[model samples]
Target chain A: MIIDGLINGIALGCIYALVALGFVLIYKATHVINFAQGEIMMFCSYICYAGSTTFHFNFILSFFFAVIAGFLLGALLERLFIRPLIGYPILPVVIATIGIAMVLQSVAALIWTFEPQKLDPFSGSPYQLWKVSISPVHLWTIIITFILIFLFSLFFRHSLVGIKLRAIAEDLIGSMASGIPVRRMYNFTWGLAGAIGAVAGILVAPVIFIHPHMGSIGLRALPAAVLGSFGSIPGAVVGGIVLGVSETIAGLYLPKEIKDVFPWLLLFLVLLIRPEGIFYTYEQKKV
Target chain B: MKKIKVLAIVGLCVACFLSFTSNTIADTGVNKKVILVGGSLDLTGPAAFMGQGVKRGINLYFNKVNAEGGIHGRKLKYIAEDDGYVVAKTVSNYKKLTLKSRVFCLLGSTGSVGPKALKPYLEEDKIPLVGPYGYTSAMFRPFHTYLFNIYATCEDQAKIFVDYLKTELKLENPVIGLLAEDNEIGQDTIRGAEAQVKKVGWQAPVVELYKRSAIDFSSQVLRLKAKNVDALFFPVISSHSAQILKECQKANFQPLLFATATATDLRFLKMAGDSAYFGKGLRSFATQINHRDNSSGAEEFRAAIAKYDPSNKDPNSFNLFGYGIAKILCEGLQQAGADLTREKLISALEKMDGYETGIFAPMTYGPNNRQGTDSVRILRADHNKKDFVIETGWLHPE
Candidate 1:
């Protein structure tokens, strides 16, 4: 039972990791939390739907294009809306991201008409091993989330561009002096974040119904980001899974009324105990 | 210094002009007469789509009445606010709409949390809150004369579902399973389902609860598939209902599913795709047809809504509910005659019985029975269709 719960928890955690990875990418490079990351994921998922249904592409091709679209849109948004606010306070950037989320949500609602779209691309039934039964849809989500995480880690570790991004994250002025295009790095980080979020959205959409508000699930992952360490990629995955499993267990074992509140309670307790995060380093900024 | 004096003079002139305009408008205004009806619609939040449909319904009836003539010569103004289905926000907004806006009466208020918050206020104000879409036993209880129910209570609706299973479907000793939101309303529904099982003298079925904003219910459905529940009873919010149905389909657990009015919507039909119209459930009220077997009222509703809310045509229980409340309020105002005080409206509402405004099932209210519509009918949604086909006529309150 513990293994079953852990497996499920880790799989769910992978999703949070993907979101957290996006956060890490943007935060490391730009020192900004893209509040609209979830909405960008949602927008990309809608694109994936359009690609699959309207354009009649297979799931993989549709998903690929969706990610690409997310990347382009993310980069474009940064150029148009975000770049103009350079050297300004971070609060305006956060608020601007929020407005962008609103616009994207409204546009999606206007186009889709507030009805949740059903996507059942996969064939066949659940795979059962003893008491543990796993649906193909969830299995798909679990697999995709892991692969994306692996690829993201690889990109950040091995690639030259990734090193440039890391340098910029470490010190923007120093990286600029070292001939790194800091602005391009910022745009690239956002684009990469958008692409990763899009992937997360698509992975989850098959199991869940596609609705405009579905992307807002990203907000729930914020605790995961904080718990995992704002800069640690793997930490987010652990935190999200921990949160999901705890919430699931609480919903069943604990009082049902406070199930939604349980995850936050757990996060608060974790924060109090370990202000540096459970798995990641506690970086103290000297003001 | 010269600039400051000049600015001060301009500001004074502007203030005077504004005051003069206000005085003129106040004197000419025919008492700013509009009967304020407060609604806790989920306008721009998670269940915003449901709110939009409800707004469509309210706008429909109000427009119809206003177009022909005002309700007792007083224009019906619905002071609708977005609660977003949060309890604390609902309480705050109810205060703003009640104490600040001072709406005449709370008509057709929806959402599980909204009514729970405003109930005490409604009671204290002695305001006749009629046709609240939610049907918690608490709404029926402690007998607040001001509180009137439109939909049958969850327990009552669950009992009717069991009745349909026994009588229409002819299923005996049926193994039932219930999936509900982990909230007061959902728990109330579970309680109602459990009671029905016991009352029918059958073995209790499995009861499952999900988080309110759960995106997927496949795991829960998989467990139910193992149980092989013959009939499934669950009251789901708009978004989650569609998710549950899709998951059930994926799992191939096609049990006879019965959802309350909350799940009854065109969005459900679209979301369910091929499997939309395959169940019978309790509606708050269906305004598509009347006891006289005419669609004239429904037709009028469509036309009125088209004129006002022409963009939105996706009708559901909420739309009909909106029409029903508008009709009820209009009738109450008419019965109140020329005098349209809050007390007069309450008195008129209390006196309402056998009053048919050609919209919804006949609504009756008296001193003893505060739960309006003493009965709720079972309506079956036709697959891929807009409205439900009436299965049974007005099942009396159990």
Candidate 2:
């Protein structure tokens, strides 16, 4: 039972980490939280479903199509909604993102009609290893998440665009003055976040099935992002894994009523001790 | 001549007084041209599928009725307000419908919490709510005269499940378990199953509760498997039921599964895939006849949906429920006659005895009995056909 819970928790955590990566990416680059991250994921999953079922594309082709569509959607949103309010207060931008979330959800419902649709998993059935049984989908989720993390790490370390994004995160005004094409970078960052969300959505869709409200799972990942420190990329992954493992282990021991709230409770306790999250370092800024 | 003139004036005043009193006695929502029926439903939330299905079904029936010149020369005008499954929003929609729109009665409001929240106001205002789509025991308990429930309560369904296991499956000493949502609906089912177990002189079943938002059921399945539970009763919604089935398949644990009428749909089968048809398969208790049933009512429903709502390509169990409940409400309206009022509607509904709509089990109601039926039909998924097949005739809890 313990082994099963651990495997399940790790798999669940990978999904959370994947979603949290999207949140961290947008926040790190633009310094504006994209509240619609989950909605983008949900909409993209529907697109993938449509691509496979409606358009008669194979699963791999549908997956890539949805991801590309997600990229275009994110870039379009940044250009149309985010860019217009460049000098505005963060509250309005956040509210605008929330509004965008609502619009996306409603549009998805209009298209898909709110009926839960099934997506064929990449692999069929679970493989048993000793006493523990793990789903192929979960195995794929872990592998893909690790690969994404590695790719993202290399990009940030070496790529010029990644360096410019980091510069913008550190000093937005300075980067803007240093010939960083700030608006285009912001669009690209959003597009990247959308692509990551698309991958997360398609991966998780097989497990949870596809629905308009499936994006609410993104809200669950928010705690993971907070736990890892909202701005740190590696922190999101660690935070998600910690949250998932602890939640499952707690379910094994704690009262069933507290299971849903366990993750939030763990986040609360961590925040109480270290307000800057597990990976966040306090930086002395000159006012 | 003066006396004659005075007598004529007195006669005119008396006739005018009678006319004023007659107009005052007329019902609020009933008019010469139409009868306004209203509903507060979750048209744009997590349960939007249910809300939309119920709405479409009701509209399908109403459109058919209206096309046939309506009941007693008054057309049925349905005005549905989206509550989004929120209690406060349901109450607000109720107020808008009754106070503002002045609907004669509420027909097919979805969800248990919303209808439960409206109980007090329903009684206080002396308004009739006919055929609300919920399975909670509270819908009929304490016998709210204004609220009419159309299906067997979750508790009754649970009892029926236990009975089926003992009588049909012949599992005399089988270890039983329950996986339910941690809410009133879950508690109600638990109460029924436990009571039935005690009645049958069996060991108390292992019980596990989960949150509604929970997608993963690995821990619950593992715990149940650890207990060696041979049969499991899950009274959760369709999506959760499918997820649990998948989890069980992953863990290589195949227990005889029992679910509520909510899971007796094609969608559940699709979601669960091969896991659903594994082992003894999922035996679900259904309140309404399956849409694919060859019964006359089922045929009529399919034809009506095709004629009235061609846009709705896939009609499921919820839609069938909505259509069944609408039939009952319309029956009550027909029985109430042209001089319609809330009280008359209530009186008409209470008098219904073994009224068979062909879609639902024969329903009987009395002044004290608001539950339309306590009987449920068992359904099992046919893997080959990819649809539900009716396993048993309507079985009563007792």
Candidate 3:
């Protein structure tokens, strides 16, 4: 039972981690929280559904279609909503993201009509690893998430665009003085986050089913980002895994009524001890 | 000359009194030309499918009746406000409908919580709420005089499930398990199942409760598997039920799964996919006949949809329910006679006995009975045909 729980938790954690990575990416590069990350994921899932079911595209084509659409959507939203509020207070920027979330959710609902849709699972059946049963979709989610994390790590460390974005994150005014295209970098960062969200959405849709309000899953992933110190990419992954595994384990052993709240409970305990989180070190900003 | 003047003045005063008394007896929503009905529906939220289906169904029946010259030379006008499944919004909409729109009565409002919240308002205002779409026993248990329930309570369905397991399946001593949402509906299901178990002198079944927003059911399924129960009663909505079925398939736990009428839809088959096609599939208790069935009521409903709502190429169970309930309300309206008032409508509905709407079982209501039906038929999903087939005749709670 414990092993099965662990495997299930890890698979579930992969989805949360992928979504949390979107949050971390945006926050790191732009210092703005993307509250609509879940809605982006939901909308992209619908795009994938439209591609596969409506246009009769194959799996690979549908996947690329959704990811590319998500990139453009992210870039467009930043250009329109966020860029206008660039010199405003941080609160207004956060509120604008929230407004964007509502509009995206309402638009998706109008287009899809609140009907939950099905996506074909990645594979036919579950594989039996001794006593633990793992579905192919879940296996693919774990594999794909890890691969994306690796690629992202390499890009941030080695690529010039990634370095430029990180430099903007460190000192926005300094990067502007150095003649870096900060606005374009911000746009690219949001696009990258959106593409990652699309991947997360398509993978999780088969497991959870697709709906306009599936973006509520974003609320769950927010805690994951917070637990990972809000801006650390690797911390997001570790925090998501810890939260998921502990939640499943608690559900297994504890009372059934407390299962949903166990994640928040664990987060509270962790925050009480190490406010900086497990993977990230927090430095107090001297304002 | 003075005597003639006094007689004329007295006759005019008597005529004036008669005119004022005649206007006082007429109701607020019913005028000489039309009868206005209103509803607060979840037309844009999670339960939008249900709200929209019920709305469309009600409109189909209303249009049919209106084209037939309406009841007693008055047209039926239905106005629905979107509550988005929120209880507070439902209350506000109820106020708006009653105070501003001044609808004659409410028909087919969606969600258990919304109707439950509107009970106080219904009672205080002395307005009738006909054919509310919910399964919570609270709609009828204490018998709110103004609230008329059209469907069987979830408790009634649960009892019928237990009875089926004992008699038809012959699982007299089999271990039973229940996985239900943690709400009034879930509580009612537990109460009914436990009541039946006690009556049959069988051991108590295992119970698991989950929130409505919960996405995963791994632990619940695992616990049920560990218990090795023979049959599981899960009276949840269709989408969540599909998720549970997937979890069961992944765990390789194949128990006889029973659900409520809400799962007897094509969407369940779509969401569950092959898991629904495997083994015996899912058996559920249904209040209305399936739309795909060849019964006279179903055929009539389909034909009506084709004619009245041509855009609705595929109508589901919720639409059928809405159509059936609208029929019942129309029946009540007809029975209330031309002198319609809120009290008259209530009396008319209470007088209904063995009134067959063709889509539903024989509905019987009395002074104390607000629940329209107490019987339900069992249905099994056939994924190949993408529809549900009747498994049993009308089964009643034992």
Q: Indicate which candidate wins on TM-score.
A: 3
| RMSD of every prediction | 7.3, 4.4, 4.4
Q: A168-257 in candidate 1: lDDT tens per residue?
A: 877888998889988888888889999998888886675566778877778878888888877777787778778777765554455546
**Model 2: colliding residue pairs:** none
C-alpha RMSD over true interface residues, each candidate: 4.1, 1.3, 1.0
Off by over 4 Å in 3: A282-287, B1-27
TM-score for the second chain in candidate 1?
0.81
Rank ordering of all candidates by TM-score, starting from the highest: 3, 2, 1
Local accuracy of candidate 2 as per-residue lDDT tens digits, B235-326: 88888888888888777788898888878887788788888887668888888898888999999999998998898888877788778888
Better of 1 and 3 by TM-score: 3
Clashes of 1: 1
Off by over 4 Å in 2: A282-287, B1-27, B310-312
Model 1 TM = 0.79
Models 1 onward score TM values of 0.79, 0.93, 0.94
- Model 3 agreement with the true structure over B1-398: per-residue lDDT tens digits: 99999999998998899776644323468877688999999999888988999998999999999989998988888899999999999999999999888889999887778888999999999998888888889887787998888778888988898899889988877889999999999999999989999999998989999998787788888888889878988989888888888888777788899888878888778788877755557888888888888889989998898888999988888888888989999999999999888889889999999898998888888899888888999998876677778999888897
lDDT of 2 by residue, A96-201 (tens): 9999999999999888977788986664668889977888888888898899899999999899999999999999989988999988999999999999899999
- Candidate-wise lDDT, in order: 0.71, 0.88, 0.87
Residue B214 in model 1: shift from native, Å? 3.0
Kindly list the per-residue Cα lDDT of model 3 for residues A93-166, writing each as its tens digit.
99999999999989998998898899864845678988888878778988999998999899998999989988
